[model samples]
Target chain A: MTAAPTIFLPEVPDGDDVGLAPSISRFELERFICGELPPERRAVIDRALAADPALKALHDDVVAADRAFLIEQPPLPFFQRPAKAPSWWAGLLSHWHAGLGAAAAAAAVVVVVVVATPDESNRTKGGVEGPRVSFFVKEESAARLGHAGEELKAGDQIQLAVKDVDKKALVVVGVDGAGSVTVYASESVQGGLSKGAGSPRVLPASLVLDETTGPERFFVVYGDDVDTLLQAVDSAARHLGDDVKAGRADLARTDQLPLGAAFPQSSVHIVKIR
Target chain B: MSISQMKDQELLTGLYRTHGGRVYARCFYLLRNKEEAQDALHEVFIKVHKNLAGFRNEASPLTWMTRIATNHCLNVLRAKRAPWHEKYKQEVDVGVAASVAGGGGAGFSLLENRELLRLCLAKVATTDGSLAELATYAFVDDMKQADICVLVGMSAPTLRKRLREFITICRAEIEAHVPGVVFAPAPI
Candidate 1:
């Protein structure tokens, strides 16, 4: 398995660790609702809650909400793709900042992390002019999206694309807002302990536009930190750059999951051709 | 072929006959509406036909169709912001609530606990990260963390971390809004 980009996570501060990390994504509470999670796992969670009264209170809320989601839902006319899905085609991407102008864009755009050590030798200082990278982030279950979309700020919409994200093994893009984009998927990017290396993840990026750089539009990538997220995105984009278009061809492989070597349908990727 | 010209309207009909009950049950779980579930049934079939051209010969047509059903139901939830639905309260086994509230699942009277908390959840789900709202649903239903991980694409460890954060927010939010519950200090 290929190694993951080394990221130093912060140590759990004293008084914060209750035998487990407290920080969690909304995704975990949702798995229980869909019947997707197993039983023993729930036991562990329950026992864990016995230690945290706060967790128990929150657990009660989750239980109520899950039941609510299972109730009759209102009419949703918008979730379906517009008759024709939007074109998520390939393109040259670059980073920009607030001070950047149209004139600066003509120079090769490189959405570098002002926070990154700026070791120009390893990464492209010039985004379009530099060598290619691969990156893609996927939000898997979205069990809570229906209710969550309400909180999405207008600027929160993070737009990312490559000719073919699936083609490459790794790719990276940059963000300006620093915390606007979040790479979401059902599994962790570094879930290497369980799955094999090279598992796909939707990585995030951000930027600080300036006189020499920055594109016309601005973006803010959030969730994971910007510099680290950008590094991972660069990796995935680079990896998949080869087969973004060809990647769709393998939508043929979803059947492999259930049928030993051949699973049945591959629905998510089919609709995500870029 | 046009929608009108397809012949396995017979097979479609037959599949519906044999599996419609089960499939509708799945749709109801997400949609929570009988009519909407019925309407979604039509759309699911249209989707089945549209994608049938690319259907690989791997899984049985039934398995493939069921997957399409599940995906479509999720889509329906997404398209509609999971609007509130009319609920039939008697069916769900109220769990500990039965012991505490002396009523069936709906009858459980933690009104003291549930009333203010439910409102806080509504506020956060509608405002903060909707992930919290989704988390509330799964946790209450007692879903495993792994299932939530698979469905939402978040790491399990990371998810565990998030559930804790959201709970803190919920408790504080409830205490501030509700009259009796003692709220924990918000995590910085």
Candidate 2:
């Protein structure tokens, strides 16, 4: 049989070399940077980098790229169990309906707004200031602001809006009476939720109250890192345990969620009458 | 934080700092779009974070990460139903014409021409996905047979057979794209 026709191709570049000149493998360089390498191995790489300008250049380029990435996407904070609310605050929460009524009468608004007491740890850490969520109920075609402990019917459409916070990412999760969780709104891969400067920003989507009867709490988790925000919300949900899921627990009076001080959080609590 | 927790944090931070760029580069190389690559980069890191414990034992964490990136991108390409070969049909035709006219024989360097490389990869990709992955290390990364064996966990003979199959598919694809152009199988 005749020999197969030769296909002309350039020599395969050595996998270990970064650029034109030969050097150590990229993995070795990375290990060096990470301080994972043994001292002797580190010395070898150091000498190689020192001797080869091309290797040094590659190292610098990698460092700069990682630096830019870190700047754009910062590291997530460590998880921490949230502190318990004071006994006095818990006592005040027991008279939540009376408090809500007084506040509503003072404002002369149809909606009763219940805002979570900001976590003191967050405040002490100088977290985002005045991060507040407003609840709105839809009646017919017109939507009105919603208030805390309002009797909402099944299938009533409601929405949430945020004001006085400038964060790169936001996630809103709802824990219904049945303890089933729903994500109302979240940041997209392209970027965070779109908002106008210094204006109350309504989320793009609205929620229709489910048939589950009892308290429905919406938690707003906001931070610069979307991944961390999601993790925090998930961790908090896990911490709520079976009591909330069994509909035996009132989330509003429950201790704050176990989110780090870095994430500014707020919540709106409403009751489903049906 | 506990001492163990602190160490875990440092390890994760170091991993991100050291290999994040290379991972991004690998993602961009395969996906060929900045936005898609960015999405893939985040996804790959999530996998890395989840598998962080296993990384310390890995002989070559970069290779392990590359495998993850390749698999993820291939899945994406499959999900999008993007015909990678069809997208670069015009480029292949033009390159073939240039090579024939210039009397450069019947072959060209695969890595030197990225469009052709992508076209070959698309043609070689199959339901198994291993063949395309093998082709990437063999052709794109230019890894040695021994290294490819270790990276992919295949015997040398199996690798040769799979590569031969990959070449057969690529040859058929090139002929189909540019009629009258017959490629001689290059040595693996």
Best by lDDT: 2
lDDT of 1 by residue, B1-188 (tens): 11122232333443443444445554555556666766666566666556655653423443345456656665555454434311211222132223324422222222223333343344345444445434443443334466456556777677766666666665555344333433233233
In candidate 2, stretches whose alpha carbon ends up further than 4 angstroms from where it belongs are A1-7, A10-274, B1-11, B82-85, B88-108, B178-188
DockQ of model 1, rounded to 2 decimals:
0.02
Q: For candidate 2 chain B, which ten residues in a row score worst on lDDT?
A: B1-10
Docking class of 2: incorrect
lDDT of 2 by residue, A63-137 (tens): 787676554433332211112311111222222212222222322222223122222211112334546666676
Model 1 chain A weakest lDDT span, ten residues long: A256-265
Off by over 4 Å in 1: A1-274, B1-33, B52-137, B140-143, B165-178, B182-188
- Candidate with best DockQ: 2
lDDT of 1 by residue, A1-274 (tens): 2221111112223232222224332333333323334678666565657787766676576566434432322111111112232111111112221211221221112122211212211112123332212222212211111110122221121222221111112212221111111122111122332242222221222121122211111111111232343344434333333333344313222211111111111111212111
Candidate 2: true interface contacts recovered? 0.16
DockQ, per model, reads 0.02, 0.20
Estimate every model's Cα lDDT from 0 to 1. 0.33, 0.58
